[model samples]
Target chain A: MLQVFPDLKGRYGDFGGKYVPETLMGPLQELEEALDQAMADPAFLEEYHHVLKEYAGRPTSLSYADKLTGHLGGAKIYLKREDLNHTGAHKLNNAIGQALLAKRMGKEKIIAETGAGQHGVASATVAAKFGLQCIVFMGEEDIRRQELNVFRMKLLGAEVVSVSSGNGTLKDATNEAIRYWVANCEDHFYLIGSVVGPHPYPRMVRDFQRIIGDESKRQFLEVEKELPDRIFACVGGGSNAMGIFYPFLGDTSELIGVEAAGKGMDTPEHAATLSKGTPGVIHGSMTYLMQDENGQITEPYSISAGLDYPGIGPEHAHLFQTKQVRYEAITDKEALDALKLLTQMEGIIPAIESAHALAQAFKEAPQMSQNETILINLSGRGDKDMATLMEHFQEEV
Target chain B: MLTKTSFQGKLTKTEDLFIPFIVAGDPSPELTIQFALRLQEEGADVLELGVPYSDPLADGPTIQRAAQRALKSGMSLRKAIELVPKLREHGLEIPVVIFTYYNPVLQIGHEEFFQLLGENGVEGLLIPDLPFEESEEIRNRSEEKGIEFISLVAPNSDQRIKQIAEHAKGFLYCVSSLGVTGERKEMSAEALAFIEKVRQYSQVPVAVGFGISTNDHVQLVRNHADGVIIGSKIIRLIEAEIENIEKGRMDEALKHFTKEIRALVQ
Candidate 1:
C-alpha cells in the first residue's frame, strides 16, 4: 500500500514531472502503461531477471577492500562490484530492462543518449542481443574524450550520432535523442541511460537499477550479517547511485551521493548539482540544475566525462531536500588520487566516475572505527577511462 | 482584458489568421521591437515571441540556432517579458503571445509570471513543454490574470485532443507534425487528419504551427485550420537578412518576407 517513489503523477515530492513536449506525452504515457503492466506480469519479470542473471551477470560480488581499508586505518571498506557486470558497468541493468520493455511493447528500434559512452555501450549491447536497431546520440566533446567506448558502441552495431550543439555534452546529447524520439516515436523506444528524464523513466530506471542494492543487501547480510554503516556512490545523473541506494532507502545506512566538484565548487567549473544548483526543469524533469540567474542551464565540468552532467536526478533532488541523502563534492584531484590509491592498494582500477565515490569513502573511512563498515558502489571498470587516466598520469603511466 | 474575441476580430471574412513567431532578441532587443512593429504593419494577425532558453527540447535546428543567437545577445525571461510592454508602447495592437519553454515560467513563480504577462499587455502564452496534465496551476493563474493560456495538441496526442481543446484559450495550437518546430517539405496526411480531429472539439480558434512554411503550406493549412503560425522559416528569413539589418537596412528583408506570406495567406 505504501509507495516508495513517484506517485500517480510521477513525482517524488515536488520534483519529477513529465515536462516534455506534447508529442512525447503520448509515448511517455504509453511507456508508463506498458512498464506498469510489464512490471506486474510474472513472465516479464522472470524474463528480465533471467537476462540480467544469465546474460548480464547479476549478483555482482561485494568484495572487502582489505589493503585499502588497512591503509586508511579506520573503518573497514567494502566494494559493491558493479564494475564486474557485463559491459563493465552498472548501466547495463537499466539498458537491459528498458530493452526488454521495448521488446514487449513490440517496438523494434531503440534510441539513447550518452555522455561517457557507458550507457551507449550498454544500450548497444542490449540492442545487439535483442536484434533491434540502436542509435546513440553522444556529444562531440564526449565522443572525443570517450573514443574507446564510442568504438565499442559502434562495434556492437549501434549508430553513434555526434551532436555538436550547446557545449556538446550530455545535455545536448539528451536533447538530440529526445528530438529523434519525437520524430520517430512510432517504432522506436527511447532507452534513457540515467534516472533522470520524465516521470516513469526516473522511476523505471531506479526500479531496474535497484537490483544492485537488492543484491548488495543480500550479499552484505550473508557475509557481514548486517548492513554497512554507510553507502557511497557518484552522482552524474544519479542512476548508479539511485540504483544502489533505492533498496536501502528505509534502512539506517547513511546514503552519501558524491558529485564531481571539477576544479572546485567555488570556481565556475563543477557538476555539484545538489551542492550548488537551484531547482529548475531540464531534460523533462524538475530537478536541481546548474543554471544561471536567468534560468539558462550552465555547462558543468568534471575530469570524469561520465560525471560531467549539470543536473541531478529529480529523486536525488527530493532526497537532498528531505535530508534522506547527504551529498558531497569531490574534486578531480581527489578522485584521481583515490583511483590511484585503489589501483595500487587493492589492484582494482575503477572508472574515474566511480572513483568519486571512493574519494568520499577514503575521507570518511579514516574518521570512523574499524568495526564500522563503509560500502562504496564501484559503478564501472577503468578500461573506458584509460585514456583519461593516461592523460592525467602521463609521466607515471 | 484581452480574450479570444480580440484575436477573432483580427481575422477578416476571406483571410486565415496569420501568426508569425520570432525569437525575441534574435539579432538584438532593439531589432526584436523593430521586427514586432514591422510584422504588425505587414498584417500579422497575432505575434508569438519566443524567450530563448538554453535547452529548448521542442525546437529544431533553425529555431535552436535562433535561440542561440538570442541568448548570445543577452536575452533572458525578464528581458523577453519586458519586450511585450515595449511592443504595446510602440502602438502594436496585435495580440502578442509569449512562446517559451516551461522552466523560465516556473523559475519566476506562476502568479508572478502571469502577473508580469498581464502587466506587460501580453494576451496569450504557449509553452511547448507544458502538456495538458501539468498545466492546471498555470492555466488557472493565467485565467485569473485574464491572459489566454494556449494549449498545444500534437499529432501523438490521441484522445486527449478533446480534453485539451475543451479548455484551450486564445486558440488550440495544433502541432502540424510530430517533431520540434521546423520547416517541412510537405504536411503529412496524418497531420491533416489530426487537425480535422482537433476541430471536432475545438470551440476556440484552432491555429496550426510547426513546419508550416511556404505559400503551399499556408494554403494547405488554411483549408482545415482557422490560423497558421510560422516560426522557423521566419527566423530563417531574419537570419538571411541579418547582414542587411546590420547595415542599417532596418529589417527590410524580413518586412518583405512577412508581406509576401501575408499576401499568400490572404
Candidate 2:
C-alpha cells in the first residue's frame, strides 16, 4: 500500500503534486531524477546511514517512562528519544540525507526555510560539515522567538534571512525560500524542512525520516516482546509524526497524530488544520489547510513555533481521510502543563512541539488499561524554546 | 457570455505586442477599469488583469503591494472575472487575460471557473504555478471552452521547451528572466537564446515577460520575441500615483501614467 501510494504524479490520494511556477518545473524534474539516481546508488545510501550514526547520532533510544507511567496510573509510556540526536531533533536525519543529495547532484549552494529553527540548525550544521554554502530563510517572528537557535545557525556559518511577509511565520518563510529557489534554482538546492511541499519532496523527506519508526519498532519489540498499543506524535507539517507513524501504519497498533490547538478548535487561532481546515493547495501540495471562503490562506496561531503552520502534510491528510490514523488537537495550556509534568516527573524537557503529542498521550493513557502502552516521538529538545518557555511560564517558575 | 477574438489573433494583425498587467482594484474597483482603459489607449494589444491573491509566489514587492491594495478593496478571483464585462462595457476592446495562482481556481473548480471566464469577457487564462505537466486538465477544459490557457516557458526550460510549445494555445509565454515578476536593469544573453529556442518549437505567438522593464530591456527583447509583457513596472507607476487616483483626479494621473508608459515602450 505504501509502495504504490504517491504514484507517478506524486499524489497521496488527492493530495501532493508539483503546483509550482513554470520556472521551477525544470528544476523539480531535475531534482526528482537526481534523487532517484542517488537513492538507487548503494554508496549514497551507505554514506547517508554512516553520517546518521557517526555524526547525527542515530539509533536514538526508546526509554521506558516508569515514573510518568506510575503517575498517570493507567497505560505504560515509552518515549523514542529523538531529542538525544546531535542537533537535538529528528530534523537532522532528513537534513543530512538531503544535504548529501545536494552534494551528489554536484550543487554547491543549498537553501532552506525553518519554522522553530531546528531544521535551520540542522541544515547549517550539515552545510558546515560538507563545506557547502548555506542560506536559511526564517520568519522574523521565529527569529525573535528562537534566539539561541538563530545564533547557533550563524555560528555554524549559515546566512539567515528574515522574512517579514504575512504575519512573519513559517508560511511566509517558505514563500520567501521558494521565491528565492525559483530565481536561483539553476545553482541552488532548496532543502525543504517538512513533508509538505510539492511531489517527490514529501516522499523523499519521509524516506529519510522513516528511521525513527524502524529503530523504535525493533527496540520496543526487544524490550516488551510486543508492539505498543498506540503511537502518538505531533503534526506540524507532519514530518516527525509521519516518520514514527510510517512503519506502524500496517500494524495493529493505533496511530494518532496530535495537532496544535493554539487557543481552541472553535477559535481562528488554532493550527489544527485537519480538524477545521478544508482541502486546499498550499506550498504546492493539495491538503487540509486553514483558508478563507475565497481560498486565501489564513494566518495560523500556536504557542509552539514548530506547529504553527497552516497546513498539514498531504500524506497525513490522506491518512486522516482514510482513517488510517486518528487526529487530535492539544491546546497551548495543555501542552504547557504536559511539558511541566514531563520535566518534573521524568527529568526530560520536551520541545513544545512534542508536548502536543505528550499531552494527548496523557489524556488517552489514563483511560486505557494498565497493560496498554503508548509510544510517543520526543521529536526535539526544548533548548531553543527557552525564551518562549520563560515568557509563558514566568509566574509559575 | 461574450465571444471575442483571441490574443494570438491580435499578434497576427500587429507585429509588436505590448501587454500591460495591473492588479484589479488596486486602489478601488472603479479605478481598475479606468486604469485598464488608459493602458488600452496606450497601444496595449492585450491587458492582463491580475486577480489579487494573499500569497502570490511569482510576484515581486511592487506587484505584491498592488495585490495587497487590491485584496483590501474586496478583490477576488470571482470579483476579478466579474470585472471583465464591466471593462468591456467601459469600452476596453483589446483581449483580457486573468492572471491568478492555482488555489483560487482549485477552490472554484475547473468546470465552473472556465464557465465564468466564458460568461465574462475573458479571452485567456494564465496560472503561473500550473506548469505544462500539471496543466493538462486545465488546458483541455480551456480548449473545449475556446479560452486560451497560455503556456509559460522559462530560460531553464531547455529540453522541456518542445513539450510545452507543442500544444501551446494562444501564445507561448517566454519568461525574460530566471526570477519572479519584477523590473530589471538589464536582460541576460541566455534569455535571448531561450526566446529563440522556444520560437523554434512554438506554433503560436511568443510573449516575453518577468523583468521586461525599461527601454533597453524592451528593445533587447523586442528583437527576439513577438510580444513584450510589462507587469511590475506598470504597477510601480500606478502605485506612485495612488494618491491622485484616490482624489478623483483620474484624468490628470492617467496623463502622467501614459507619458511614462510611452517613454518605456515607444
Candidate 3:
C-alpha cells in the first residue's frame, strides 16, 4: 500500500517543509530519522502501545449519543470518547508517543507549548510518568485563564514559563517554544502539542494520534455495521481532528472540521483558519495562516482558548485545499448553546474546544435521515473549561 | 561614497568586517535611513537591515522588540526592500544585506523578491530561518539575480557544516551559539572551534553572528572569523535612542553608539 502523506522531503503537497532556523535543521533531520526508525521497530511500537494501554487508558469508548440524536431528531450521533483518555484530552496520545520517542532517543528533557493548557498538562503528565524533565511554554493570558491547568502542570513537576509577547496567547507561546527548542536542541526534545509546525512533527503527531480514528473506525463498524456518514471535529492547530480524520481518509465518510468563530467571523474576532486564512507561513510550515496582506500574522480571538490560534496544520490546509474535508465555523454562542444542550441531555460537558465540533454536528445532524450516522470526536473533557463556562453561564450556574 | 563591492570582493580588502544590523522602520523608516548612513560613516563594512516580522523565531527578546516596533511603524518587506533604493539614492554605497525571515520573501514571490532586491541595489541576503536543506530554490534564484544568498552554520551542525560551507555564497554566517540572536556575557568556547571547523570545509569567508554584541565579542570573533555581525546590541541602542531620534537629535545618539563599535572593530 502506498503511503498517504509526507513524501521524502516531508512535504504534504507543498504545505509542510522544514522551514526552521539553521540551528534546528540538524536536530529536525535527526528527529525525522529517529522517527522513521522507531516507527519501523517492532520493539518501539510494542512499548508505545503497552504504555498507552497500561498508563494512558487506550481504546477509549465510542458512545452512542441517543439523547443527542433524539434532540436533533434527524440522524444517529456517536461520540468518540477521547475525553475519557488520561489528562482528560486527546493531547496525551501525541504527548505520550513523543515522550517515549524522546526516551528512546536518550533525550532526558522535553518541552511543549500549550494554549488552553490541556497539551501542557498532558506533556507534564507524560514527562512525570517517563521520568523526563518537562517545561511548558504558555501565554500569560492563557495562564491567567487556565490557572487550574497551570497548577496541574506544576503539580506534575513541569516548569511553566509565561510568554508575554505578541497577543500573549497560543501563537506567541509557540514562538517562544520554538525559540527555546532551537537554543536547546542538544539536550531537549520539543514535544510539539499539535499537528502543526515543521515537517516530521505534523507527520509524527498524526501517526501517534491516528489511533483515535483507527479505534473509532473499528468500534463504529462493530456497532453500526458500517462507517458513519459524517465525522465532525474542531480544528485548532488540528491535532485532534487530524487524529480522527487520518484513518478515514479516502473513505466514503465525509470529514468536517469546525473552527471557532469567536463573536462572529464578521466582527474580525475568530480563529477560523481554514475558513478565513490565506496560504502563508507561520510557526515553521507553509499553511493557511490568519495574516494581513503584508504577511504579518494577525491575532486570533476565540472564547475557547485551545481554538485561539492563527494557523492550522499544513496537512489540514492541504486537506482543505483538496476538498477532501469540509471546513465550517461555529460562533461562540452556538458552541455554548451546544455545550449546555449536551450537558443537560447526556451529562457530557465537553471542553469549549470540542464544543465547536458539537455545535457543528448539532446543526448538520438535524438535516440528515435517521439511518445516517454522524460521529463527533469529543476531543477533551470540560473540567479545564469550567471557568469559561461558569463565566458564560453565570445565571444557570 | 563607499565603494559598491560584492560581499566576496569586500572580504579581500578588509581583514575584519564589521556588520551592524538595524530593523528598518523602527520608530519610523526615516530614522532607519539615518541610522544606516550613520553606520556606514562609522565604518560598517556591510549593513544587515532586518525587515520586521510578526514571528521571529530566530531572534531573542531585544531583536524581537525591535521587530515589533518596526512592524508597528508599518514596515513590510516591500517597504524594507524599498529602503535599499533609498539608501543608494542617498549615496550610501555599502553592500546592504536584507536580513529577513523566509515567510515575507515567500509572500512576495521568490523571483519577484530577488528581482526587487537586485533592482534596489541589494548585494546579499540573509534569512535566518531558511536552513541549507530548504534554501536551494531561494539560494539558486538569488545567485542568478547576482545577489549573494548567505548561509548559516551552527555550533551543533556536526558534519553538516561541510555541506553548508561548500555551497555557502558571499560569506558563511557562523552562529556563535545555539540560541537566538542576543548579546551574551561571553562567547561560548565552542564558537572558535566551530569557525575553525567551518574553515576546513570552504574557502568562503566566515562571519560569526549570534550573541556578538560588544567590543569584547568583536575582539574574540575577529581572530577566528572574517567578520563580526552585531544585531541585538545595535537594536538595543536604537531602542534607547528612540526618544532622542524622535526629537531630531538622532545623529548624536546613533553616531555615539556606532562610533564606539566602529573604533573597536577598526
* A275-317 per-residue lDDT for model 2 (tens digits): 9899988998889998898878999999999999999899999
CA shift of A125, model 2, Å: 1.0
Q: Candidate 1: which pairs clash?
A: none
Structural similarity to truth (TM-score) of each candidate: 0.96, 0.96, 0.95
- Where does model 3 exceed 4 Å of error? A1-3, B1-14, B178-189
Clashing pairs in 2: none
Q: Please report, in order, the local distance difference test score of every candidate based on alpha carbons.
A: 0.88, 0.89, 0.87
Better candidate number, 1 or 3, judged by lDDT: 1
RMSD of each: 2.7, 2.8, 2.9
lDDT of 2 by residue, B1-266 (tens): 11222663543433477889999989878888988988888889888889988888887778888988988999999999999999989998888889999999988988889989989958899999888877889988888877788888887777889999877877778886633235554445666667778878877778888876688777866776777899999998898788887787878898898889988898
lDDT of 1: 0.88
Q: Report model 3's interface C-alpha RMSD after superposition on the true interface residues.
A: 1.0
Measured by TM-score, how close is model 3 to the native structure?
0.95
lDDT of 2 at A247: 84
